[model samples]
Target: MSRSVAGPEIERLIQLMARLPGLGPRSARRAALHLIKKRETLLGPLSDAMRVAAERVVVCRSCGNVDTSDPCTICTDAKRDPSLIVVVEDVSDLWALERSGAVPGRYHVLGGVLSPLDGVRPEHLNIEGLVSRASEPGVGEIILALNATVDGQTTAHYVTERLSHLPLKITRLAHGVPVGGELDYLDEGTLSAAIRSRTAF
Candidate 1:
């Protein structure tokens, strides 16, 4: 018969926080305690920010990226190359690529990869939107930056088949060993991909 430490409100907050990604019950309890201690400085401001984000944050209709605007900053940026579009599985993937600063073009988020076992299909995803976007003029190439999983490759193949009639070049991200990875530590799939995609040196 262990006694509960906090009141209903605090316990509710901790429970809610625990539902967030990467935060478990123990971490959520610690976070809730910290927030309670810093009610005025951290907690209040965070609550306000979350409320504002909840009100303003929206999914970009065109590209499927989450943003405060419809077209999103990436879509509206004039400096980005309009001829190229990198297709990713989610907004998180888009953000990862943005951090790299390697892509000077825009992005198209597919919402998710094709997973038949998980009941995810082409109709459930933004595949139609992608096809429509690819059909638009000034779009020359589409780079698929999907994960190297079976679902990701299946989605890529489906998209490629759908867009085959369109006069556009479709490509996928290159797979290989990491920059400093040793041969002994590398997996067979990675080794095969590295060999297959080897460049002329």
Candidate 2:
């Protein structure tokens, strides 16, 4: 059995922080100590922010982006082009595209790719919502901006099949993405190039 070096509250904080992406046990401990050192300056503010986020953050109804609003800021932007909808595998991919500033349009997040091996299926994703959005007026193009993985490609193909009957063009990102690269890990230049060089699917 492991002995606690700190109180239960501090140990609990470390455990929860360790669960965050890119954070391990040692890193979480370091972070917790840092936060404790800066209790009034950082820890308090961070706790308040996290509380607000936990209480108010929501999944966007239109694009599946996590935000404080139902449609999200991207979906509600009137200046964005309604004719173009960039379909991504997750909200992380949507944020990556937004960081590139290459897409002047809205987005549709699929939540995840089709991974039959992992039991993920079409019904598990937001595909039905995407289909309904594509059928709406002013939606002229669908850009499948998914990662370059087997599951991503499979999801793209499935999405293409579903949207094939619509009176709109379907396109995909260029080969700037490596065979197994994810959008979130890519730099802005590569993502921008991929978006600019997208071709018909």
Identify the leading candidate in terms of TM-score.
Answer: 1
- Tens digits of lDDT, candidate 2, 22-92: 99989999999999999999999999999999999999998899999998998999999999999999888
Candidate 2 residue pairs in backbone clash:
none
TM-score of each predicted structure versus truth: 0.94, 0.86
lDDT (10s digit) by residue, model 1, range 1-201: 124688989988998998999999899999999999999999999999999999999998989988999989999999999999999999999999999999999999999999989999899999999999999999999999999888999999999999999999999988998888999998998999999999999
Clashes of each: 0, 0
Q: Which ten residues in a row have the lowest lDDT in candidate 2?
A: 171-180
Off by over 4 Å in 1: 1-4
Q: After the best TM-score superposition of candidate 1, give how far the Cα of residue 108 lies from its true spot, in angstroms.
A: 0.8
lDDT comparing candidate 2 with the true structure: 0.93
lDDT by candidate, in order shown: 0.93, 0.93
